[model samples]
Target: MRRRISVAETAPTQPGTTGSFTTGEWWRDAVIYQVYPRSFADGDGDGMGDLRGIEERLGYLSELGIDAVWLSPFYRSPQADGGYDVADYRDVDPLFGTLADFDRMLQTAHELGLKVIVDIVPNHTSSAHPWFVEALESPSGSPERARYLFRTGTGAAGELPPNNWSSVFGGSAWSRVNDASGEWYLHLFDTSQPDLNWRNPEVVDEFKSILAFWAERGVDGFRVDVAHGLIKHDELPDFEGITGEMLEGGGNRGPMWDQDDVHEIYRGWNEVLKAFDGDRMLVAEAWVAPAERLSRYVRADEMQQAFNFDFMTVGWNAGRMRDSIQSALATNRAVGATTTWVLSNHDVVRHASRFGLSDPSAWPKGISATDEQPDSALGVARARAATVVMLALPGSAYLYQGEELGLPEHTTLEAELRQDPNFWRTAGVDIGRDGCRVPLPWKGDAPGFGFGPSGSTWLPQPASYSELAADRQDGDPLSTLELYRRALLLRRELQLGRAELSFNASTGDTLDFTVAGVRVLANLGAEPVELPSHHEVLLVSDDAAVDAGQLNSNGSVWLR
Candidate 1:
């Protein structure tokens, strides 16, 4: 019974008035592909991905049907926190490439009709940054020390840390400087990364200049790192009931994160973006609480987008997913901003592995090799289904590198290869994120898998990766890469991103919705479920055969 509904059929085309993409507000519903430079490709065979690698891969991204590429930081650094500990905001790290290499990458991307968004870390700077170096040299209470959050310790001989706050990685957030004064400075992450004093006018001015420097070079936007943490409560006080759950964007509120004054900094950045010639944008990486608080970061006068962690971390339940979606959409709508949907990124476990767990309702802080492993077959199936559902939703989407190839987290990464500070600071108790950050496999049946001409990669590729390599899946109609490619192309053709989503029907076991004439259904229950009336089949997850309009359990599809 393949029932065709003519009323649901509509011509496939982009919604709204057509114009030069440059003149349009392209980011409104854009599909932005996130490129983790170190793992994407290796151009110079340095066993590390660099600007040249990204330049070479621009055509691949374009073919994947992405509107823009958001690159992780390649700024000069000690590599203390995988480029998050930025030492120089104005220069490229030699490990990644030179400024000339960056410019060429940007030029090639623009020529291919893709916008570029660079990561900007304003919340903290590497200890090697000139400002931090000068602050360390100056005595406590000096003007140089004022550039950062340096405070006097509270114990006898001032031995104890200034406050009881703990780092997101591990241990105390305040690190005692070894200068004669023996004062302490704040670092919410690694000690090699020192928090900047936003209260200081010099810190504010320096960041403004950093923004302009990149804007002049034609970057389309910025992804603000730790966007909610620049401001702190004036009185540095000890955290009383702070727990780990509260640290990673849970229902926690405190002095160090999601402060009111953070909005002001983004407002200032918004003005700078407005002054630019094109429709430049700013997206926040603020790991803030409850859906409502996340909305505050994207107010009309602030940043344009913030990662929807609520959607990303919610369990694989129909009821839970629907609730998260409704809440996110309603909240962002109040601020006149589009909701952003993301499943996984560089900092979290891949949703493929995450969904394979018995219960994926709440994301764990970290995954270790010794931990209970995921069901690989189940995980891959769910991941493919999830992609179709995500692309069918309203608002913008972010696709992490290697996800389109259906890669899973390398759960067995050796301790020696782990680089995330969370792993080192926690002393192997937490596996950190190196599993999801493994170098991508491109081709061949062995190590590196075409990541470089010399077959060398920073992180070892598993034997299992050979089947999932890009070259192997390039033309396979049933491959995850092709599924994403077709879904993305169809998303644009149907104008799904710009269309308003409506709940057509839903049940305890199944969730159904319609957007831009396409019906999206997800079967969360044990038994196969029947889809509503539609004119055509768009896509389906692994093994989900749409015979007689029935979608299999743990499967999803797009119709009409």
Candidate 2:
């Protein structure tokens, strides 16, 4: 496959009116820190980041600097699709914690000046869920059947999927309960996550109940998963350009990807969020959407924000970073909605080791005596550059859990044993996300990846993580961990993420620009380049050793 290229144009970098941007208080300038619980700090010696563990780590979040925290789903699940296959919307799975534990987390997070946002899987419930179970046994017109998108009397029939669309996880988008009814349920990702029929009024009201369930629990907001794929064509149109990847296992195409119907559904959800006025935030995960197309979901009547992966998609080059930032700004402004920056997430390789900044022969796990270390100062410099670019850009800056510590990518295939379902799906063809999702290193010498020494862990801990653990580097003034703290603190101190871009231009690999007159610059290159006396320096990655005349490697500065 040649790979599909996105057709999104970049945006300008000019400062506009203050209230000119969307006036939503919850996210106007908030930093959404994403916590992949399984890999975060493990509490209870389970090697998993449980609710109580997250509660204990709230101070780490506040200290690192962030306005909101987006927790990946912890709901009751069967692990067929992580916790995304929700068995119950209102309960936390035992693997993570209980419902009450979640309550304390939200309560305390709010008390700490941080907002608690949970993942909302509105599109489907686990096949094992009570409603799905009952619907499996019921006849048409039954009340339980109304909860899902169940269609009958079609062939290719139950053996085939509901449509020609493809599941993102590979295989057909649909699955059959039996041959008797000869109908299939739709799943956009995995078969376990049956796509809900949003056209059904009952489904709408029921989700209203689900939303209220969390909002009532004192949760601040939600990170909407696959938000754009919610609504189908209403006719479930045939999927076009289906490839071998799309036909991984069987024959079912899932959601109406990038279709307009999704916009209507988002608008509906925003209507529900409006009930909370400007207090609630709605951030959608739309990976392929361009700024122009994505803005449709962020209108005042639609969504509060959408995840902006511009930097995430670009190569780790200063020129690219500068262009991406400027283009993203110009595109979003043209579309009438600004973007929220997303540098890394659970799905991709850690940027610390992925950018190939070092010699190709020294690939992390394959390191030899002569090659540079995987997270060499060069790597650290690039990671820090990524931070400066993210924090100084307009809109929200999201920080993934380990990114603050500049956590390196895993060096061993042993990380495979950590129980990532994506790995199980391929039976080893792909490096399971388990490496990135490993237990967080807290105590340097503690076993279970410092989840605890001699403590039980849900996943096997990495042996080499001691150097990267919080215990070892917290006080080290030159460590990557300290630099992250400074980057986040810098983000907070300037409010530049909230301020519009006043200026941006060529200054070596440095993406030099200004926000609210705070001139910000970052050198994406490992070897920094100096700039003319164009502006003064406000903040650099605290780790970088450089002067105003010479932006010597990993250098970042914000001018007043």
Candidate 3:
């Protein structure tokens, strides 16, 4: 019973062509898809995803109608925190593929007219990194030790940590070294990931070379990981305030986060991005907020875009959604930068499952198998509605892999199979993000859902995934995958990404707005709402939710 609409065909632009937009500004309203390499696909039957896996899927991404693909880190790493704990910034991990495999993937993506955005981790390095290894070998105050934050402990025998700061992954942020000096080092996340000293000139110069290294190889952009944590207070200070694994908004600023000096680092990085062709750009994965303050990171000469986490944190409420959208648009407008909208990423529980929870905002870390489960049916309906509203806004939209398939978090993942460090670090209390990062389902009946030739996956998929596999939904008009395809096609044809938003008259729990002369109506309340009269129905989030010109609860509709 799903409604379908015909969209006029338009010739596709060649790769590297920025059509209609100002030169080098394709990112302004681009729809970029986040690809977590480890969970996307496994090309070699090795029970792990690799560059060859992604290269094999370039055609799938192109067919998905995204403008660009932002790959999560696949660099050489111990993967203590996935690829965030990078050991070598310039090389691909053997667990992923060889350097040639990366080039081949990059080449294939470009040939498919998809821009490539690589993740850049600058705030820290794996303990096994050459710099960190040398720092451990060197004595206190040695030049090698200067590369990282290694300070003498405070107790009589230098036993206590230098400060009271806690790690994002739990435990003390400072870990005492076992060397002669018995010094302690800073690691904001994990013991294996050491925080680098941005005050060092060598660190700054090294990142510039790394940027140029990737830029020369034809990446269209870089998604700077932990973008706000690069520069810390010169004198590391104690922060007694409660800290979570991720910053939710602007109020959590402290010695280790959102420092003013961080802008200098990004400004220098912007200069490096400008030197490349094809409108090379940088997007910050900064969790800093108070939309106004977050604006500073996207100033003319800084990063082109920063993730708008505020929008994602706001629960399934019409007023809250409207406020977030308006605030993001107004703030970015002040800095002449376009806003970025994201519903879910690898670090958090998938939005589909979150929307199903009684208190949607309660479990950002994730849920365990024994935890209170969400209403799966309601979650998918609400997630579909939310995505429609997000896509209608005038900004760049980022889609996490499998979201278009309406994939929910693997909340039932067994504790024994969990690999997220947060789970172990918190002694299973935090549950961790492994549920959302489970390998994607591609084929319904194939081994590992066609993720690999072998019937093995790094993380097991739920039994329900077979029904939601790409092959099962490939040609089904009512399937979530098809819904995304149709929506994306309309988005490009209508130029919704470049449209301006204006709220229409609406009452409680119902959001009515217009973008580029198209009316978008979302019903968040339990009561059904009447659709705008005399307009052609362009799309609906749930087919059954719309009946007799009325949109039922947790449904959204587009009309022209």
Candidate with top TM-score is: 3
lDDT of 3: 0.86
Which lDDT tens digits does candidate 2 get at residues 1-560? Answer: 22211111111122111111233475777777888876676667655678888888888777666778899999888977668899988888898889988888887887777888889988788899988898889876777777777775355434555557666655667777673675677776777788777777787788778887787667778899877666777777676744213232112234465567677766666667667643777888765444566667777777777877555766566665666676668876765666788766776656666554454212122222243436545565667766766777778778778877777666464533545544554454445465566667887776564674346666655566777888887857566676656556666556676677855556655677777777666666567476557655545564333453666666565555
Error (Å) of candidate 2 at residue 324 is: 2.8
The superposed Cα distance between candidate 2 and the true structure at residue 91, in angstroms, equals 1.4
Instruction: Report every candidate's CA lDDT.
Output: 0.84, 0.67, 0.86
The lowest-lDDT stretch of 10 consecutive residues in candidate 1 is 11-20
Q: Can you write out model 3's per-residue Cα lDDT over 377-421, one digit (the tens) per residue? A: 999999999998888889899999999999989988888888888
> In candidate 3, residue 384 scores what lDDT?
93
TM-score of 3: 0.95
Instruction: Give the runs in model 1 whose Cα sits over 4 Å from its true position.
Output: 1-23, 247-252, 543-545
Residue 400 Cα positional deviation in candidate 2, in Å, after optimal superposition? 0.5
Give per-model CA RMSD. Answer: 3.3, 8.0, 3.0
Winner on lDDT between 1 and 3 is 3
lDDT of 2: 0.67
| Candidate 2 Cα errors over 4 Å, as ranges | 1-24, 140-143, 151-159, 242-255, 334-336, 357-377, 415-418, 507-510, 525-528, 534-536, 542-548
- lDDT, residue 250, model 1: 51
Cα lDDT of model 1 by residue, 1-560, tens digit: 46432211322233222112544778888999999999999899989998999999998888888999999999999998889998899999998999999999999999888899999999899999998899988887889999999998987889999889988888888898887898999998899999999999888888989999999999999999888888999997777744234555454467887788778788888888788987889998877878889899888888889988778877688887898888888888888899899998999999989888988564765567788788988888888888889999889999999999999889888889888999999897667988888889888575589897778888887777999999999867677887787778788778898899998669797878999888888887879887676357666655444556678788887777
Candidate 1, residue 3: lDDT: 40
lDDT of 2 at 137: 90
Q: Name the lDDT value of residue 206 in candidate 1.
A: 87
